[model samples]
Target: MGTVISRFLDALRFWFAAIRDVLLPRGCAGCDKPDEVLCASCTRLFRHVYRKMLPGDVGRCYGCSWYQGAVRHAILDWKDHGDEECDRPFALVLADLALKILERQIPCDQARALSLVAAPSSVASMHRRGRWQTLPLTRLMARRLNDHGFSALARPVLKLEGVQGKSVQAAGAQSRSRRIEGHVHVTEDLRGDDSLFIVVDDIVTTGATMGQCISALRAAGARDVIGLALACTPNRDE
Candidate 1:
């Protein structure tokens, strides 16, 4: 009876949200362009490919936008504030980033099998948010990649253990690295796997978390690993 009641309440909430959306359409999450989830201009911001330096042989990671101003605001809305409406737009942008990375790095004909990995969120974070935020992005990316002639699968094979606090709460690169180090781990063996693993994340603040993810995959015997993020923080010189 309790489970049924909980599900009924969830359904009621969903319908209420739908009705509210129809009655009072919200402006763009990125910019206050009336009735848009993410305005065209802001969507374009997510189209630029920004490179971020990573640790070890991984060297670099790619993002769709520089995390600042409107992009940051929009992401926070979707990620922290439960703006689930932004999922579709964000997923499409991530898929576009995946294609961009593939085009620049390897020809489609020569590309290996692809695996889309959602960067792990801590258990506490998932509980707090009521979802694994990146999971939908990865799944949608896999679908889009498959539509474009790539054999891809969304694999949530990464896990974060013993992590405390949030990445946003961490101040500097060194602090961020320390927070994630020794905590990101692979849930399965990748020994002898030849697939190209792509880690999908919303933000690459310091590249430490991404580098650790790539390193963990390599340690688990993944031959090739790369990261694709929705946004990246700019370097001081940039």
Candidate 2:
């Protein structure tokens, strides 16, 4: 059966990873601690919620940690490099972040399903990476939230078109916003969507991209929209 095959493949992957770890002897993605994907000290850094301001009336954005030092290294390893093993841990951190945000924002009595929207990836980036990286993180985060008694689902409805270079390479807020302007689009008609849309991204430098994503969703008739990132660059004002 398909279920049997899936379990078998899962087990196979585990054993293969174990064997590879024994042979290759890798280190923590964050600190290079031997035989660990992400050491406890580094993971503890991701447990805290850091708030950053979004442009205009898009409201605040939440991040799991500040994008600096070990946090930045670990994210770059997982994001740019081929460290796929960091996905589950990063997803859990993001899920914890969502719960923390919802605890303060939404009351228990007033419950609604959550739609986890992965930030759009440009075609060039996807082609270079060979995958839609943010999509998997959003999917895993949704699963984690569902396990914690929330109606959560992953919705990859956003798209990026006509984007050149990368957001990180852009200098300031204005340049980044201008580069992403008119490029972030909603794939389907969300005219009657009532779910709380949580946009997930790997990083929030100036929050321009996150703001743009929120704007696109709002334009497509998505009412309740917010942003969450795995990590965010330091804000001196905040």
Candidate 3:
């Protein structure tokens, strides 16, 4: 009887959401046209493109796409606001970048052994939103990687504290500097032997957040941690 009630409530909630979406339909996040969340044309225009990573670049993490214009607004809407429809297109971009990394850099065998660690959403934000958005995006990317012959699993590794401030434009260089100061904690029991772990996030700003998360993973004994993200802001100097 309890299970039945729970299931019925879940169905009712889903129906309510459907009706709300239809009644308060949103425009394309990019072009603001009244219809789809992200119009087809915007998806094509903002297709994911790969960027090269240089050797011995510790603080410099590899990411795809410039975080500006459509990409910037889209990510803010999804991450800060509850723009749920942004997940699909965002996941597609992340998957494309991961594929590029697998093809040109990470070997097929190594890629298969990799575990994806999604940067944790803030506690307050999660409580308010009722879901960890990054987890779904991570799962979507993992499925794509697995389909392409990579063994990938999304693992929750880090947890965030404090209220998320207004979105700031972070420079890649400043991201490195801010790393030495932030206090982040790892809440999960991670295997030290998981040598190939990809830290996944929706976007990388100054990379300070990713750096803090990677630092926690390394402290927890992860052998090799690679940072991956859907989009990145261009450096201030760029």
Candidate 4:
């Protein structure tokens, strides 16, 4: 029954996209280029990987692009402006980036599962958006990885709890840390799993949220937890 419903919803989404494209064509979500959802130029912006390490975390983090220019604009649309159309592209890009990161950072044991743990969404955000945005994106990334012969699963096991609204985007590192400090709660017992869990988020501004995710998951018994984001805000000094 769940599979059937999923298929039905997928079909509905497809038709809805087709209709939207035909009836209300718009310029590129990024850069306002004419007659494109996301232009090829904007897509090219994400080809490079921006890898970095956050403070007070055991795992390294990787991003597909610097969070600026077209990349930032496109992500904003997909994440905030109800532009669900960009989900597939973003997921595929992220999956590709993850594969590359896996190649460079971790050995492919084949026996171990690759878990994509999406960043937790707040109840208020979910209520306002009427969806768990990262859930589907993470699911798509898992599917993409599986298609490439990797055992991957999307797990929404992390929960953000007991915080005021809109707190993840605090200004500086200290502010960000204080806002989200101890608020990330792991919802399941994934501890001691023989899997490489990658915490995926849309953007990494101060590395605070990603660091917290790594700490929380590791504390919860996840043997390995790394951060993956669509874009990373470049260092301010640089």
Candidate 5:
């Protein structure tokens, strides 16, 4: 009953925000600059790409920017504060990162398709956000890849089970890792098991979630899985 009421309230909030937007236009999500969802200056901040290798032979993860200052504020607004308009700009940056990685993996004349897998949102998060945050970005990315002559498929086959509370509620890396353990698994309905997968996330913190995503994909028979985040936590101890 509580969950039902919570979802109801979230739905109400969603509609209210939509109505408000139609009534009074808002400014940029990264800053209060007028007439843009993301201004040029703010958009450039996402180009601060950084890479981190996973613990094992598992492939590396790339982040467009360190999660701090403007980047952190922008992500929080987009992810938690209902700034849906930021989706495209964020998608553009993520797609750029994916393309850069692809260049190194394959020759310019050779076009290779990859599976763009979005990190699964928990049921609670879906209810709260009234949408899957990463799904839109992933979909747009696949489209952008195809437009650029690379075949790509958006695969949202992973599902989160038995997880509760917001990721922010997790106390530390150990706590986050423990809570998510055994909770992420691939849905049996996914196709093309042998395709390379690029796990798409809005942010990478502690790297616990990305690691779990790779594990779940590998267990489901994926031959390769890498990660790309819009940003990653700066000075993350874990």
Candidate 6:
């Protein structure tokens, strides 16, 4: 009964949001343009580029490139603004990146053995936004990857601690200066000891959050962990 009520409520809420978008028609969050979540030109701007993870890069685990430009903005809006319309676009970007990783990094057999793991948002953030952004993004990406002949599953493996803001500079400093402290908790036993797991997030800035997640997964006995983000702010070398 409770699950049914919850599902009904969610459907009602989505209906209301759809109505709101139809009536209000807000501009794009990325470029502030009219009539779209993201403009076509803006969408074209998101490019997948390789970025070297610094020594001890955490959020995106081993080596991965964060998607940038319009892709980043779309993710932020969906994540921060609770817009469901952005899911397809965000998933498209994630799928593209996943395909590239499969082709380039791991051997063909190893790529076939990997699965997608989504980082859970902090409880506070979910309460405020009313959704788990990473899960949706990961599921969408997984679907696309599956279509392209890669074995994939969305595993919610890491849970975040409550929301607490730290100085961006401080977080970045910690990522570069020292090891990340507390941030993630693993809740499940992942399958296949040899399988590579890629952790996905919407955005990564200081990498402190990702590092914490990686540490927890590593502690939980995950053999290999990789971090992937829709967008990342280049670390400021202080």
Q: Residue-pair clashes per candidate, as listed? A: 0, 0, 1, 2, 0, 4
Candidate 3 residues lying further than 4 Å off, grouped into runs, are 50-57, 161-182, 188-192
Candidate 2 C-alpha lDDT tens digits along 8-104: 9999989998998889998899999997989999999999888899878788899999989999999988878878989999999999999988888
Candidate rank order under lDDT: 2, 1, 4, 5, 3, 6
* Candidate 4 segments exceeding 4 Å error: 1-20, 57-59, 167-176
Runs of candidate 6 with Cα error greater than 4 angstroms are 1-11, 52-73, 162-180, 236-238
Per-residue error (Å), model 5, residue 71: 0.9
Looking at model 2, report the run of 10 residues with the lowest lDDT sum. 164-173
Question: In candidate 4, how many clashes are counted?
Answer: 2
Best by lDDT: 2
Kindly list the per-residue Cα lDDT of model 4 for residues 1-238, writing each as its tens digit: 9999999999998998889878987788788887887789888888777876686645458999998878888998887778887888888889999888778776677667998998986677777667778888899999999988899999889998975545344345467567678899998887568889989998887788888898899889998778899999886655
TM-score of 6: 0.78
Give RMSD to native, each candidate: 2.2, 3.4, 3.8, 3.2, 5.1, 4.0
Consecutive 10-residue window with the lowest summed lDDT within model 4: 164-173
Using all chains and alpha carbons, the TM-scores for the candidates as numbered come to 0.91, 0.88, 0.80, 0.87, 0.84, 0.78
TM-score of 2: 0.88
Q: Rank the candidates by TM-score, best first.
A: 1, 2, 4, 5, 3, 6
Stretches of candidate 2 off by over 4 Å are: 1-20, 108-111, 167-174
When 2 and 5 are scored with lDDT, the better candidate is 2
lDDT minimum window of 10 residues, candidate 6: 57-66
